[model samples]
Target chain A: MVSTQARNALAALAATAGMAAFVAGCGTTSDGSDSASSGSGGCKAVSIAYLGAKTGDSANLGLNMVGGVKVAIDDYNKAHPDCKVTEKDFDSQGDPEKATPLATQIINDSSIVGVVGPGFSGESDATGKAFSEAGLVTISASATNPALTTNGWKTFHRVLGNDDTQAPADAKYITDTLKAKKVFVVDDASDYGKGLATGVKKSLGSLVGGTDEIQQKQTDFGPTVTKIKASGADTVFYGGYYAEAGLIAKQLRAAGYKGYFVSGDGSLDPGFVKAAGSTGAEDARLSCPCGPASADFTTKYKADNNGKEPGTYSAEAYDAAKVLLDGIAAGKTTRPDELAFVNSYDQPGLTKQIKFTPTGEVTDAVVYAYTVKDGKIGDATVIK
Target chain B: MQFFFDHFFELTITGLALGSIYALVALGYTMVYGVLQLINFAHSEVFMYGTFAVIWVFTAFGAGGHTSTGGIIGLLIVSVFAAMLVSGGIALLIERVAYRPLLKRNSPKLVALISAIGASFALSETMGLRDRITGFVGLDKPLADYVNGARDNSSLPVEITPKAVFKIGDYSVTTIDLLVIITALVMMVFLDRFVRRSRAGRGMRAVAQNPEAAALMGVNAVRVRQITFLLGGMMAGVAATLYMIRIGTTRFDAGFILGVKAFTAAVMGGIGNLRGALLGGLVLGVAENWGSAIIGTQWKDVVAFILLVVILLFRPTGLLGESLGRARA
Candidate 1:
């Protein structure tokens, strides 16, 4: 009886496998026609897809990018009514698994001329290959992993400086300005965080007191706090987003560590202060490539978003969207034309002159330092 | 050796505080397993709901900053009660929705376990998507704010400041630590004594031993199982409040790893044993901290599982052995 049951199960599995293969073959043939038609004949209403987490832990950053994209789209439509553009937003929730299908959808959707972002490095890394293969040009506002540009993706571009550019300023602030004899580094063990942490470590050299890694979404930092306390480093530089950074900062302070706590742009959110509490976030500094949006842009954004000022990458996101919109306005409708246009694209933007290297990095992006004073992110000071 | 000695007192206090939370959460897992002989994987969601309950309560009251001692005590009492009540309700709901139907149909234990895993995901994802749900309901202003606040680590305004009560060596004992450790001990002791000398507790033991026998002996087996989940969830609720107070922040998935550790504690302390849960939690917590101190922080979780494996290898029945249902036999 058992042998018969096993044989039947194997037979059923083989039949199902055969059926799936037949279906998949049909699916590919249909998909090829769909992409071919969309690629050649652009839709009457062109869309710039905004892809990122608009609802999860990283929603603050993603929403800001969306807001910036919205403003750029609106500005472009008002200026050029004859060549109108629309925006398509996809919420990846800052998860790579979610971004993969969304990337495919964006690629298959022929109406999408360009992308404003895959706001996070993880999502960009996950979807870059698909976008590159589909010849979809994605101008990321915030993804800054140095390796993202080196992935041989011809259609990928970012408006913000990568870790390679940002880390030198961070190391300088830690070693020269703070002048700490000893420094400890912590990362969330992501492609972005580890890259930035390692870069800082290389710059600091012998001044590096200790180094540690943490997982994303990890809450309890009791052991990590103890380890940091024992390290006796005068400065602690954390390379992670706000959620973990705030908790670590709070726990570290509660444990009576009075040293300087520095973090990267990933932690530059109002939520950081809210998470760290007033006392815990005291004197903490956040370094980022993008600063506050321009005064006029800030006022306009506040009006648009119920008096909510744009967050960390809002200015850069606006710049990124502007770059793509400018390319679209210049009659770069098809994916290949837009990709080529963005490659040689040079225009003044909200944050900086929007120009990309052959590798798709912003050539003249500047890093800025912002200190947390009185429980708020203070005005940015340009860090040379 | 010097590092260990220097940080000994600090580590010990931190470990004890951490252990107290594990013990509280582990009781729910242990008690449910004691009666059902199945892991209610959704017990973690019960604890997570308790954390949000405290957040909702505190936020509703606008509780923030340093409160007066009396105010702090009052807030703690109210929040703890709120957490317990919400968690208990959710636990009962889970058992009713996820476990009772399976029990009635006499389904396999694996099916019930799978149901519990589904319930766990459903609860956590609901919390994660609370904002979207609330917005859909058209209560977008304040309700959306509350739900979105929980999307990430919602840092509660510290209602009670952790003042240094005393110093042992270079480590100072804070009031929050004392509160967590003391509250956990009190709850555990009360639970221990109650289980040893209560009608319901006896019913629980009878049901655990043999449901048919217990049903024959005038104890409602189903009711006893529900009560067991209730008691366990209440304990977890108290654990949640203490956790939020000690950690000062709670996220939607906060209970996951901690729940795993608590389950490991339950298994380590002899799955069905009451005292074993406490012993297992304290031992696991201290050992994890010490292991991290020695090896590194990233390997802290690795150290915890390794210890669990080593202990189980030595004594498969666990350190204390299963004794929940045995009546002095």
Candidate 2:
């Protein structure tokens, strides 16, 4: 019995060793094959990728941008059938950790010549360096954190103006227009929200009454709302996406706060109005670098997307895609050639005359203040 | 100090309402741990599905913000029952599929725990991918529409509006707050009575003490465990509806943090003690609010966990220091 047991143990050990070796071998072989397959220079049908959340709390924003990019791709493909351009979508689910792996995958796939988005500020911050080192050209349509541009990523660009531009515009609207003396600043503690809140705080100065932080996906805002009530602030500036912004606005109103509710581009979606309810979102103001898409673009978007009106950043996404398609049309097909083309890119597109600075900042980006009136986001008026 | 005094009544009222939710969810964790000595990590998913059930029922009836007071009451009852049935069903399914197999094989405690975690993830991701799953099955459009979408924060149209019911000092109490608190108290009283006096409750205690010994007493351990899960899940379902009424929104992962807090409450109250769960939850809720009022809102969770650690250091078995098997009603 003892001898048989010893023989079985030896067999088990050998089997375990063999399995571990097999798994390790598989990993190395896959990596070698992946590298071997890429880096071929030939006339291949190049594609641009849309990297953002297509399903989640922020799905509306990402899906809308994808819609806009698809329009640009359709127009480009229709114009140039031989030099065919296609779009591949990568869903990050609005998570930064997910974006990192997807970014690495995008970098490995050499067929993807350029990218239209990583849509959110958090995802952009997470994947910026990987794309930069890989020399992959990425033009973000929505990410507005000013710190993103400061990362010194040569391949990164954005069509929207940064928070530094829009925060002051929001502060001016709150202080000069509404003339609110005491303002309470709140953020969801996300990278995007905190940066914008800090910018608003700097612009507001002494008018800022206090600052508070909340987590994303927080449903109850009673304690924060009560604190806001006690602070006796006449204006409440929230720096977060539409999900929490709507709840905060609704709860603040319920807690008897009747003041100007102001936020940045993150709160510029129609879902914000739906979340806040018509009564809660009455007279709420949102400042964004992206103005309303022109009537023609809106019509085209509606036609393409089954009559679903485009939400935040759809126009800018179209413009970003146009920048790449224009470059490809002008004989810039390779990654290096596309990067150089976008670096010195200048053209009139849907949103505005698109031009990138050396640091990838839009040359003439403008901020617009939008008001919620009668349960609808009103027409955008230039903040200045 | 001034902030504390001025908002004392309002803070207390809010704390009580929030505490009631924690208490309902805590009962589930405590009871499950009592019978199986396993923390049902997937209890949060049970609560989450309860929330969806509430939404589905309301939507099916075409209820909206404009529903009348009587209509709201009727809808609330229907939705609460629907939530309870759905959550209880899901809880039984989880036990049969995730835990029973491990228990039958006499697996190590650590393996059962890992299984619980896996089950938790599976349920949450399934809900998150509801749309894709429905689309793949080629369900009819209207049915698919109901099952799909809303992976993010979805708010139910306000069926019950908060109207001032009465005033306490300078603070006004709303009808919704009163309703939630009263409903929670009623459920707690009924559960307490049922556990102390019922025959099945005695079977649960016997099994919790020793499954083999309980088998010798002719008590069906398997049936007793299922009943315990059903009871816990029903309480969680009630809590889910109250949470929706109070917060007015639900998300796929909404139950995660709340579940952690509820489990912490159960541990604080002495895991497996029913009455202790209620006391622990109320204390946690009030303490967190008052702490936030004193310090800052951002430090509320920090203060709660700190209090727990300090309490554990003193009384490791928790405040009441008695499991369900040994405790009186």
Candidate 3:
């Protein structure tokens, strides 16, 4: 396991070139959790930590969250350079096993007052209890497994709806919008994928033709495709991230399924279209709980990051990070105070209106249905 | 059970295609093992580089778009040659850098094994971190298309999507299946002829049987070893090209699992035997697909190894006895 202090010191030095004083200050506060210099509107080098996949198979998805967090940090730093908070990356690689040890190391750091993400569902489930026990605030931008909230982690909060909200809406879109009579459900057998598939299966009770489970990195979908084609399903609904989902979509089209393909938020990125090919991805419906990005925010985000478009939950991540930054700006520099401030956070964000249930579920969610046209996932229109 | 029987033919054909990839890649493992009596773990990186060569050559040709059949054929020939060149070069370099030093030092076989594993990691990271490497040399922007997405999947979507050529029962059979299987067979036949009838093949066999004796007989043991690695690398190049055509995407780490499967195929076929690789690959592929169809698609990964275990239990020397030294010459 990587020591958080070492990673942070190295990153701080490389990123700033002159954070020796801040590094020394953080060292002094490493123990006795309450050792940080507090009680002022201006913070003393307290930072926001990003816990997500910086590298791995789902890295493309996790990177969008990193982009959002980066934007928030830039905005905050620009507004107040006097108290510039650093952002350290703890790359969990979206694997629960990797995330658990990283989570332990993260809680041991006194400088990281809040966390922006534990991106995927499984990683969130693995790291949530540690953050809660340490009284550290964590707001996930994308993890949608519904069972997450049932764990009773007080510091846990989400900017997007759970799988229960998104999956039912996705099923409705598949049935009403596409008018599909038979739907074959497939999951990557992940916590997020299985949970979402269960909801879709329940909602599309009679319409489901068959269901199958696929492994995460297993590329050959030949047997599953054979089964789906044999079942005579009109539409194939995949519950997985873009990495696998896009390949599944491509293989299905190649096998002459010739039916509509549907997926949830996990497949909403440009990578999906690239994976499925321009023509293969045409007319594929993607249901996401992420509200449409405001034009101003989109333009700003693009300019901020090499003209690359925001991915599925980038907007929600931007909002989640801003919420934590706002808490710090308002004098909540410690973990407990930051948690309290986020617990009562209620404001309109770039993505949606932010308010949470007592159980940490977002008060309401609006799912948007997006379709691929000419190899591009077009702008979203409200579906639920 | 009924689904397995009904779709068995379809599963078998596609399985054969997937197995062809394993067979071609397995030849690399079996050949190197035959010559050096060392598992060339870094051979997977040789395969991966060849896939990138295919992608890069195509990307540079017509900006990755060609509609006409002639254009596609021209692209295919040029890309395959490019893949073979790149893969063959990397294989030679690995021989020089990773294995040759250890061999010269008369190091323990375990030390050479560690060197091969280290070479595997080094080669994998070099490809994975290509963007940074190119950037460090101030060529990132100039070489954006190649170096970009250093770690993510480099998807090469089919421009001319393959059409179904025929129907086997209810399943539509496509050209990709035929192309992959036929290519593997051609390469295998060519390799077999080269190993059996050619002078260099005779030298290789002599070296494998007894390197010191072959050296005394003026066989040039080092040259024979180099030829073995070169042949294996070219075969890996063929496998890489087929994989790109069928899978339509490649990542830095793409070779790991496929390499494991191919190695398993080689072991199942008796590690040093040539023909055994093809047989083991086809069997494993068909068994896994059938296993998925019966138990569930989720069990597909374990099915191959489980079958291997069962087969190994019965035939420890593998389906065919291990023999490159004892080939019926």
Alpha-carbon local distance difference test for all models? 0.82, 0.81, 0.82
Best by DockQ: 3
Off by over 4 Å in 2: A1-60, A73-138, A147-156, A323-348, A374-378
DockQ for candidate 2: 0.41
For each candidate in turn, the TM-score is: 0.86, 0.85, 0.84
Better of 1 and 3 by TM-score: 1
lDDT of 1 by residue, B190-296 (tens): 98887778999988988888888899989988889889989999999999999888776777788798889999999998888888899899888888778767787
What candidate 3 gets wrong by more than 4 Å, as runs, is: A1-140, A143-156, A303-308, A321-348, B65-69, B157-160
Docking class of 1: acceptable
Give the top-scoring candidate (lDDT). Answer: 3
Task: Show how many residue pairs clash in every candidate, following the order shown.
Answer: 0, 0, 0
DockQ of 1: 0.47
Q: Rank the candidates by DockQ, best first.
A: 3, 1, 2
Q: For candidate 3, what is the DockQ-based docking class?
A: medium
> Worst 10-residue stretch by lDDT in candidate 3 chain B?
B61-70
Q: For all the predictions, what are the DockQ values?
A: 0.47, 0.41, 0.52
lDDT of 3 by residue, A134-194 (tens): 9999999987777889998998899987767887898888888889999999998876678
What is the lDDT, from 0 to 100, of the residue B149 in candidate 1? 63
- Candidate number that wins on TM-score, 1 or 2: 1
